[model samples]
Target: MEKFRIPAMRYRGLVEALQAEEIDFIDEAKEFYPLELVPSLEMTPYPHQSEALVAWKLAGRQGVVVLPTAAGKTYLAQMAIQSTPRTTLIVVPTLDLMHQWYAHLVAAFPDAEVGLLGGGSRDQTPILVATYDSAAIHAEALGNKYALLIFDECHHLPTDFNRVIAEYAIAPYRLGLSATPERTDGKHADLNILIGREVYRKRAEDLAGKALAEHEIVQIKVKLSQLERERYNQLIQTRNDFLKQNRISLGSLQGWQMFVQMSARSQAGRRAMLAHREAKEIALGTDGKLRILVDLLAEHFPARILIFTADNATVYRISQELLIPAITHQTPVKERHEILTKFKEGKYNTLVASNVLNEGVDVPAASIAIILSGTGSTREYIQRLGRVLRKGNVENKQAILYEVIAEDTTEERTSARRRGDNSPQEEKHKSGKLKVIYGTGKKQDLKAAEQLEINYSTQNKDVTNGVTDSSPKRRRNHPQET
Candidate 1:
């Protein structure tokens, strides 16, 4: 009888509550927009994609879709757009992904005016895309502008600020997309209230050789130089001593933050913090890892590769030493685009980056990924693995991810912590098909190095049969020298 407005984020819950009370209400929030005739799809959907669409529709057109990267999640979103054919807003995490969504929407709906709300553009068409930052800032204004809201990288939606964007939006139809939906903060549980439940799920292994590339993960352990090891031990001793004296335990998320805050308050704490940083740096950025990287590059010569490091400093160091392009948060937008474009076009065989390439950005499919160092976050590890798991040009071509960890240091624990129980290595080992190669440069380890070399060389041998190659490679003399 009377018209009132409620926050769009609470649309589902409010409607349910009103219905339970047997109240009659008309939803006038969704305004109908004119639909423009769009061109036909350029490519057909895979069977799994169709299944995902059906699953989402069955879920009342609202829920998250878990699909691995390079599995055409964007195209699936496009299909949803066609099926719904309503005013839609696509929210993305980064400016790069914002532009990407804008381009894909433009191409998918040529007749429809595609608008951008980030990267300095403010056009508001029927089909619009906005960065999470822009969407969060303009959430109240954009509350009722769209009937359907598609959150790309929806795992980001649960954060305090970003969650507001979803809460303020009045979209009746919502879809969240992510390769990994679990958040380190355990905030992903908020997705059920914020967006919807996950209706469709797929992992890299679940789609491997069908939707994704056949892949293997190799963990290589290398020792730090003797002098480097000494420095690393000393730094660890200082940090450990400080932690023990202060009775600080970094086992939980809050505990770590407490440690960080306490470390900033006193001289001893500051020294301990610096020592922690220096120790980690030495372990993650050791010359041994660099030497192993050089060997891996030579072994996988001419194959496209991506090198990931924990920080921009290491990224730049590797880039300068190996003469490869580096991408970091500090890289100019234009330069970043050029670097990625060239890499996609095969102009650069290898590219190194820090955390920038972990998500959002559509990096070219590389045959190999060399992760020099990273955090203990499973999400980060999965993202890095997904970077190289895209299907390659050649059939049966396996994507290889080499995780180089500094042996006898904190990095070993870091690697184990990141892998968790869901690691590809565990799955492969379960199937008795794990292809691991350890290279510590010891005389006795030469056989393992040769076996690794042989495995790489013969990866293409069984391509025609659609069978995965598991034969061990011959050992090389002085394999550490490459």
Candidate 2:
């Protein structure tokens, strides 16, 4: 069956708002808490945060919070929950995130029951966290059970099946959260009607060393090995010829996927694909990021590490080769729980996986995350980074990230798809043309630089309501402890 598009009337109205540069939405029903009593606790907020709370209240305290990943978005939800003080259903993207949100709210409001509804729905509590799948498919069963709705990672709520929750529920208070509000296909008008608009947003550079966590993105370029290089040249030629011959944008109409699929159809295609794929593989393999992981593990042996990959095959190959426990859709419930339990208990120092762990999941802050592969989804990349940014105990502030990239191929060309800025591919290797993108922003490429230099690190020592000491610390390990 063909997929149903969004409602044209509502979508067009939202487009008109953007066209006129404004914000509009259905007002959230607010009763228990008015604009004056919205904030739950006192934590120093940045200027934008204070402005956001005020705007949320002014806009009837409804809709989404579009802050960057490390920007304390959960804190906003907590304030909303505290002020509202009614039965609330917190909808999230995945089971892992469901667990994380449950933990956060439970810690904030210790007396409240933070119910869960994915992987397994728990007993009803005043507060609940459910997955998008559960909220959509089972809202009727839940039966108007919530007074307020909180949608985390809500940009993905546009699916018709998923929109059933909005259709069935009568909650007047709505809260949508994400690091971004933009969609790859420019289809976020659906969210505009259901939730709200870009109520608040901050950039990584804007928050650096100020309101948000200090972050630095060091892009490395990984060149292919000799065996792989020979094949890569031919693949690049074919890719070049295909785009040039067809005269089309490489990212348009499944251009990237088609290019990759064509490269893997036969012996010649396989050779080219290998060149491209192996180039990325070699980059991750040789990069200093791995060595950095070893160093980090040696220092923080009990740390939890979550590695993200774009390719499932790459994830499988990594798990098999490294002998690390891996999780996929195929990984059974019991097995996933066992693996995650072992990981949480510090039984395993490392985990290699794919997109499954990116958005949802309460990965520990003491651990570091490695991005072995990914495309240009800004939201996914930021969320993958967030899974590791939790405040840690003793050695909690060790949140780190490493990105590996294949040099001089599509990997090099993938940077051009930024929020409003043109990605690197927009100029380089576009429509059969080879040209460098002249831009004010920097071009970041992946390399197997030093064996695995940590791309990012944070001292996650600070925690607000619970967890972590007020200050950062470096705690040495005990040999007797596992």
Candidate 3:
């Protein structure tokens, strides 16, 4: 008799191959053990979650489940764990999610030993939750430890660095979860092999009234100041001239990449890049958007509001100007936690953040979301909208997302792109809970002594019903709490 050693990750595949060839072999690579695990509390799965669980089971317990955020994906994961009572390893994208999953497991499976494998702690319990970075770094050691693997925010697994975590795991059963599974780089196709094919999926709109709060996405177009518009046009003209001289077409597939590569080598290209950036900044950070924001705050005051911006500069600006609690990536963990705690407890009525709260973090129920600015990614739009779709204490809560864009600038196209429109014209009569309203004139009365009247009466009759005058006294009397 002859024997050959193999990598632990190849255990399942090698066994299947050998079985296919009708060859006899001794197996000893698996180190995972099955156990009897039970939940400490009773939970009834929503119809979608139960259907997702069934679909996953029918797919041989190896596949991805696509559910909108706040649609009870975590509960489905718990059910999967109970069904497959094997040593399990859950890999999350962030330390915050690592802690969240750890807490959920500890409470759900009180009899089973659960442990953390990230954030400066390492334990070898039956149930382990680890961050992607830690799991990938320690892949070799943990190759055969778990029989089941669950990847949260699984869209991140296809990255060059993170894919190795799945490649090195010998787990016989795998589950991937994400709100949006498609990747911009097209690496999401790799999920078909990394985790099994997607077995279940439900769009955010599909579960709006049932699983998520009924929501309306409102688009408001505001004009730039005369001087700002002049500067923005001049910068765009400079950038366009450079692009023309270099024969670069941003409309082409590789045009942007080519521009990036060409821009790093010459002063003219650098100037073009800077001009483009300045134009974009002007469009994204116009003061007119701020005026609209002030009105929204006054209209929806004391409602748990989440204000999103594309840059930290605007986040800090709004925070300093309006005295709202701001959370950026630079915010310290303890401070961020405290702010969110206050927000949850109603000590703070509003929070301003720059992309950090787009996904993963456990944000309390916020019925109103004001998007000052953001990129043209549908995933980002969905995540931002999801922040407010979780039903709160208010009955028949209708989540409202106000997207403020700079009219006549590139932002109009960006806004349309994110909303799945090919061009600005296509978004004019877009239906199904989406209403577009354009500013009638320029905002000339932004001075402190003037009342910023957001009169939507001339535009949409429906919008005018909610629009109101923001008296200077009331606008200046905003909360000064952090």
Candidate 4:
């Protein structure tokens, strides 16, 4: 008989299949290492955290733990390290997160040598933290060195290329952590094969008043200027003409991509594609949104606020116009670090960012989050909301998120779709026929709703609350919450 090895992620399936055929195989991927656990700090896990640890251990030390951003996921990871004392490698998505993990690990185990393999540093020790890019580059060489593999923001692991790190590593103990594990392309299903099943999960609402800060989502409707509105309508008409003539449904799964490919074949198609982009830009970056933003900043003065935009151009424009520090992919590592440090120190009250801060970056919690614009992805919305949902000093300070939407455009549809609810108001919003309709979560004041051209019948309900439950649920074999 020949001896063969398989990835630990597939251990359960392979073992079950082998046992069905009456084949005997030895399991040795998790050989114990002579690693010492030096207690550097004393910290206690939350009740749900302790439950998560129990669920992970019950799953054979291999599974993903889904928790909200500020619900102490890092502490749970540290607890995992202490429970299973071994050479461990923690992989994070960005250098900022890598450094954050490194510092936390160092404080958790002061005597243990903590190494970093990203941001031009290449130190290897019992507890090592590396960025996803660096880990992918050196996965083969460091495959067999560690007994535990921890993936922070582990939802990124299922990508075609990033999966190599997990596949190449022989570590038998694996833990994946993320606030939201669902992906637009549905590759999150591959996470079950890459790491393990999601063993524990807690949503934003599940821990709202307890673990996470109590929060409220506010939706503001704004109108474009006449000139901008004219241009936007023209561009939208141009794109719609092409779609209607070609019988292309932009709502299909591969519709946008197919449109891109077909649009490049001729001048008309190219014009249509350009019109689509310009129309989107005009809708998302309308002058009205900026005016409202200025008002919001003034209203929330002295409160730390995070401004999220759909693109870097808008980010820079907001940064320049408002004089707030901006961090994008183009920002240097050192500059990003300094900006975050200053923000944490309360020197900078407001920060504007594109998509770079959406995941895994240890951003200092802010009291307010203003989303000027974003994609239709629920994950993006949740991550942006999470940036401000961390517990704050004021016990009753309701973390507020304002989703600014352009009235009477595809943006309204995008906002409704991302909210994952198909109420009558959403149907009306998707029809691209509605004017501004603003309502607080409280009982709708008919006079106020009518004054703003709102549909009281639909506006009475809270669409923002629906956003909190939009995230896809993970099926767990064991009870998720204790």
List model 1 lDDT by residue over 1-482, tens digit each.
99566666666556546544646556555453435447555677876687677666656567888887878899999987876666788999998888788788777777888899987888878888998999999988888778678999898889888998888876667889998889887899999877888877776766767767778888888888889989989999999999999999877778789889999899999999999989988988899989999999999989999999998888888888889999999999899989999999989999999999999877645879999999998778888888887774667768888888888887776787787843323223111221221112122232332232211122222221111112222123112110
Residue-level lDDT for 365 in candidate 3: 66
Query: What pairs collide in candidate 4?
Result: none
Number of backbone-clashing residue pairs for each candidate, in the order shown: 6, 28, 0, 0
Q: Which ten contiguous residues of candidate 3 have the minimum total lDDT?
A: 434-443
> Tens digit of lDDT per residue, candidate 4, span 23-86?
5455444332436676777676667787777667656567888887888898899887876677
**Top TM-score hit:** 3
| Predicted structure 2: clash tally | 28
Stretches off by above 4 angstroms in model 2 are 1-51, 103-114, 118-126, 140-145, 204-213, 254-305, 319-325, 338-347, 394-400, 416-482
86 in model 1: Cα distance from truth in Å?
A: 0.8
Model 4, TM vs. native? 0.82
Error of 2 at 78 (Å): 2.2
Task: Between candidates 2 and 3, name the one with more favorable lDDT.
Answer: 3
Give the TM-scores of the predictions, in the order they appear. 0.83, 0.66, 0.85, 0.82
True-vs-predicted CA distance for residue 262, candidate 4, Å? 1.3
The segments of candidate 3 whose C-alpha lies over 4 angstroms from its true place after superposition are 1-10, 13-25, 392-394, 425-482
- Expressed as tens digits, the lDDT of each residue in 451-478 for candidate 3 is 2322112222221111122233333433
CA RMSD of all predictions: 16.9, 15.7, 19.0, 14.4
